[model samples]
Target chain A: MTDELRSRMVELLPRLRRFAVALTGDLDQGDDLVQETCMRALSRVDQWQPGTRLDSWMYRIAQNLWLDRMRAKKVRGVQVDVEAAEALAGPNGRRVVESRLTLDAVGAAMAYLPEDQRVLISLVCIDGLSYKEAAEVTQTPIGTVMSRLARARRELHARLEGHTREAIPRQQAPKPGRNT
Target chain B: MSDTPDEKTPAQPIGDDLIMPYADGVLAPDQRPAVREALARDPELMQRFEGFLFTRGPLARAFDAVLAAPIPERLLEAVRGPTPQRTRPTVSLLGSVRLARLAEMFRVPDFSPAVAVPAVLVGLAAGWLAHYAIGIAVPVDSRGVVDTASLQRALEVTPTGGSAKIARGLSLAPRFTFATDQQVWCRQYALIYGDGLEAGGMACRAPDGVWQVLMSTPPVPGVRAQGPRPAGEGPGGNTPPNNENVLDGVRSLFKQGDVLGREKEADVIKDRWKTP
Candidate 1:
């Protein structure tokens, strides 16, 4: 790896860990995301220019790696039961158990959001980035980013309020309700 | 968890841009009125909206844990691996310095109530104790109790001419003396030794008529003249009240000395031994 690449990796680790935590909702998974991002960034040394944001570049790599993992799992016929997935994540709650319950509920709500919503929520909500910057990172138009974020907020609110009825298997909902 | 509403209401027109900035308290000053107006219109939306706002305070509380996460030494070592082999000396030195400063600015302290409280408390206590050490004690019964004997006995009084030496090296002792004229004594002590110690010392009467430091020698020294006390650097440095050592002394007084299990006797003596 180039010296620049090595320095950049060192600089990005803390933020990478944060993003990973926000993405996977697990410390170990977050670390893995960071490690994978580092490995990919190092291996594809030519794509990184010196002047652009090293943080953003590495985040792009991480997002791609995380998305690829999700795609691979789907391809392997493993569906993501988001509710079940949420039950398994951590860094929950706040002050006492009460605080923690609040955190977990929020986490679960965020986790069950659609993939695009989840990514943008992680970017703008958990990481406190500006909407414009989040748009650039997600590689979507600003308006699309706003719409997705708005929808994400709605979904998170629904989930936290316990309005997310158990995920009814697709065939169970009225057949005509599939008008997406 | 069950207390939450069963059905999620259709969300109001709160936009991500508006909600996010509002939650962060980053909205421009003029725009707050519009957001507040919108929030007032919907109760359910307001609750969800407040959830995000309330979460930030707790999240800021929890953010300290991020820094506290002990990165296993082995993991850090693995991450830092073979540093000698990949030496890149060509990076501009100025850029590294700027980055280092930025990192230092954002670096979080170790989390935990014990660590955080003590870090601040020790410094504050140190200031107060240092002041109390050389500073004279004043016995004032601000409430007009006139119980000079109890105050003198609490200090294990020794006759020193017109005044009495309540135990010397009292770092944590309140500024007021246990006497009927406590307010007078506290004012006298403050006037004499208030310099180099806690500022604005005043005497007061406790609920039980015992006189005590209204703002007992704060645990920390005053902001001015606050530099280098270990080697006795400041004005109060020469006679810095060693609370740590004196606290140990107090502990020893009960452990090896004759202060424990003699509460009534002490109180009796405290009430009888008046200053000359």
Candidate 2:
């Protein structure tokens, strides 16, 4: 790789780290993922067009690698129950509960979301990618990106707000005999 | 109600579809006035809007901690490629200068928590007794090779970025693997002691199937400085730096190529690190 490309990759490391951590829901795993992503990007350096955005290219690689890992984990039948693990914290249970109310609460709650939603939230919310930009990276329609993003945000809001659903007035309630 | 209906439907409830876009500030300028009016008039719509807006800041800041944390030396090595040979007439001084800077960045106080004696001789004696009882210490031979069965086994089986409990109160976590210019595969790992002390180093699998300890740092006082702290906190602050000086010392060992991926590393381990 050229010196300029190497420096650019180094500069993008922080943002890549952030996206990876949010995707993996653990710091070490995230760093590992980032390392793998860097290796892939470097090995395929010739495939990357010079004028194109390197950050987006790296993000796509990280996202694909994470999804592949998750698929392989599913095949191995070793899916971790994050909620169950949190409940069994024993002495640290209270601290875990209290941590849910802090700034890190959003990150903790993000673990509950499905992988697809987590990716959208990480791309749009955390990394400051525009909806259109996220769509391009993920290769989804902009409308789908917006709706999925909206649902993910709403789910995150509900999770962070605790169990009691907020009393928002519904547009219309189903009539008693509507179906009948 | 007028006989001719208007396009502006004031009674339409602003759902999350609209509220989220508005809160994200992605809504077009023409659509903002109506959402703004709705948000001003309806308390429920305002609540939903605020809900969507709340997570953006905290979510962004939550992972800033990861960004602020020091980038592992292995990752840096992967990026910079192999260190240029100092003996080469065409090699630039910039490579050595960068390595010097990295060494300076990760410099820690010279104190090994394992061997250090406390003021209380009783505790020291008991600690030594426990250490002997466990027999789980990293003993480097004269040639700087770690001669521990547990460590060697852990290094052999543990994948990159995965940790294995080698003995009581000691865990070994391999960080990454790279090949030297001579095609020697060296793996970097952190040996975490129970009392929040961590020692990081690299071990290369010699042709004879022994993991020769290339270098190891003294046990630093923190087990991964986690959570959100201020950005740019370096050597003096609470953030624990990884064993970067070890990488600096072994810079010439790295080859100009990609670090081994998961499957490739697994294959190397399965083949017992033999030449492929």
Candidate 3:
């Protein structure tokens, strides 16, 4: 039974890693967080009753760990290495840089949010957990989850569109936030 | 109505409470028509809804790169416990503890007390070293049982959706409180140790008013024999299981009573869990 659980956890690595990366907004730190979460989970494998969603369990662990790190102020600020991103742009430098900038812009905007909102965005928007599922993971009420997520999306849309306007001339930018 | 000019009529504005869910396609079917109608009538509302929709794809795809990257070997080793050879006491007694503390901090389950004692010593010593080096108090003890004074305070006063610092390196966040079938008040919480270790469990308030730990999920034995499998051997990773939700395990412990709300929980905290 334990062996089967371990294999299932191994299978869960990719998605877990993705969730971690999105939460931390850094590859190295995210993987470190993931490692710690796995170790923590493996240690408590017995507590994990069979017939429960391992992914949700692991996500809760990761979220709690991240929140702890945040509370400790141990997490470094979100740093996007523009040089590293540019270096990856080989043949299609312009397109790659553009997309990379968009991603970085989104990351930056997400970073500006409070940690709770950032967590909701990662769980519901990025990882595709339903509002109810996110609430369960965070131990928040479903209404609180929806309201927070809604606010997060609104802020993210504003920030990203604001970023786009800064990149392009204001006149050329689409007027999404403008009132008719 | 006739007094208002046709061109100056205000467009009906959709609240985020409604439009955002509609944009995410999760809105209830009955509630969708109003939002859709507003979107159709108000170009501005449609534009705002589109803005919410636009960020979804980019945010979803932002971290896709990590998925394609290879899983790190250290992580694999973490899940697969210490290798068999490392458990053998070929090295000096202290050396094994050092290795255990360094490579497998919480993973040395099979270690006998002879090894476990020294490991604790090394952990304490390392905790002190880390304390001085990093200037933050490192907690040597990682038990999640709610025995400490600070933990007790948190369990008593800290309401659900709240957290409290139990020690320099340990924090407690209570998830929720419920009444068991026996009418005992039990609360679920997660503890984050300074060393990046997290423990979660449920504690029920005993008749004596002490929060007796009903269950704390500390590390258990198993996975020591398992080794890393090839990366692609399993099905695509990260598929969420269709089994019961994680919290379901604790459900049977409690009755069908509604989980205490914030105000009611506050009252319970104030009354010290005494029966009214």
True contacts kept of 2: 0.55
Worst 10 residues of 3 chain A by lDDT: A171-180
Instruction: Please provide, for model 1 over A63-173, each residue's C-alpha lDDT reduced to its tens digit, 9 standing for 90 to 100.
Output: 888878767766786555455344523445221224343434445444555567767767776667777888878788976886677666655544443443344332232
Which whole-number lDDT from 0 to 100 does residue A176 have in model 2? 13
lDDT of 2 at B121: 17
Q: Candidate 2, clashing residue pairs?
A: none
**Which parts of model 3 have CA positions greater than 4 angstroms off?**
A74-103, A163-180, B1-13, B82-276
Please give the distance, in angstroms, between residue B250's alpha carbon in candidate 3 and its true position after superposition. 49
Best by lDDT: 2
lDDT of each: 0.44, 0.61, 0.58
List where candidate 2 sits over 4 angstroms from the true fold.
A83-104, A166-180, B1-8, B11-13, B83-276
For B1-276, candidate 3 gives per-residue lDDT tens digits of 333212223443457777877878877787777688888988878877876786577767666555544566566556645434222222222233443443452345453222332222223243433331211111212442222334545676787766787655566767667776556777766565656555555556544343544334442222212221221122134321111112224433343476677778888887667642
Give the lowest summed-lDDT range of ten residues in model 1 chain A.
A171-180
Candidate 2: how many backbone clashes?
0
Ranked candidates, highest DockQ first: 2, 3, 1
TM-score of each: 0.48, 0.52, 0.48
lDDT tens digits, residues A52-122, model 2? 99999999999999989987877777554454224312363432334324434555566556677788899
